[model samples]
Target: MKTPNAACPCWSGLAYEKCCQPLHKGGEAPTPEVLMRSRYSAYKLGLVDYIMKTTHPDGPRFQADTAAWKHDIEAFSKHTHFAGLQILSASEDKVMFRATLFANSQDVSYTEISVFRQHNGHWKYFSGAHLDP
Candidate 1:
């Protein structure tokens, strides 16, 4: 877990408390790109509950195994290190970004285009497609 004063995992150049922490704590993200960044931060911090809560109910990625999901999230967060994030694009309810992650002392980067939906004035992750780039 990241301390409140640590640099944000999203590489936003802001303290966690001033950046993604509020989103993790229930504050609404104003844009899909912001939500994507907050979700990446959530993964780095092992905030599975926040991840689940921010996921849209109708999203294809929704899973019923809360315990197993939390366990998996914790394991990944403990074993992997978040390196950085790069926002490629943001349009309407979609965002494209690349995340740099390290595991077993090796770098692993991936990009994805994520879709978001606004529900009751809050943006939630709806789904995503991994990009080949």
Candidate 2:
């Protein structure tokens, strides 16, 4: 996990604390793009609880086996290097982004369009469709 003064993994050109740490600590993300960025940061940091909390209750991710999902997230965070993020588009309730990473010495990137909705006034990740880049 990045320290407060470290550069944010989300590639937001800001300190981790200023960029995504607040959201990891339960602060509200202002928009879907922000939420998507923070979720990427969470994956990089192995903040499984933050990930779970930010995922909408009705989402497929939330319906998975908790222990297994947490294990997978932790393993990915520890084994892969998060390289960058690109915000392709965003609206009030949706964001499309590309995430780049290096795993087993191979660089890879993927794109997804994620849907979000307010749950008790906080934005939560509802669903996503993978996209070809």
Candidate 3:
């Protein structure tokens, strides 16, 4: 668990309270890049509800089985180490990032370009294409 003054898990250099905390506490992200960073932080913090709520309902990643989906997310969050995040590029509706991660002492890092869509004027994660899979 992180204190309010600790650095954010998003690699944004800002305090958690100044950065992703607002997003996790029901504040809307103003841009796709911000949303993407916040999502990474949410995973680090095991905020399952935030991840589910920010996922686009019609997107490919959106599973109908909420219980199973939440369980999977929780399991992943528990096992994985969120090492770092680097934004490679970002457009109005897309963000490319390199997620540095480790699980079971094995490197599971990957570069992914993610798509976002506006749902009720707030950004929602739509899909992701791994560039290094």
lDDT of 3 by residue, 1-133 (tens): 8999999999999999999999999999999999999999999999999999999998999999999999999999999999999999999999999999999999999999999998888899999999946
- Whole-model lDDT, model 3: 0.96
Lowest-scoring 10 consecutive residues by lDDT in candidate 3? 124-133
Every candidate's CA RMSD? 1.5, 1.4, 0.8
The most accurate candidate by lDDT is 3
CA lDDT of 77 in candidate 1?
A: 81
User: With candidate 3 superimposed using the best TM-score fit, by how many Å does residue 44's alpha carbon deviate from the native?
Assistant: 0.5
lDDT of each: 0.89, 0.87, 0.96
lDDT at 28, model 3: 93
Give, for candidate 1, the lowest lDDT window spanning 10 residues.
61-70
Model 1: per-residue Cα lDDT over 38-81, one tens digit each? 98988888888888888888898767887887787779888988
- Between prediction 1 and prediction 2, the one with superior lDDT is 1
Best candidate according to TM-score:
3
Candidate 2 residue lDDT tens string, 60-95: 768568889788778988898888898988988989
* Model 1, C-alpha of 93: deviation from truth (Å): 0.6
Q: How many residue pairs clash in each candidate?
A: 0, 0, 0
In model 3, the runs with Cα more than 4 Å from the true position are none
- Candidates in descending TM-score order: 3, 2, 1
**Residue 103 of candidate 3: its Cα lDDT?**
100
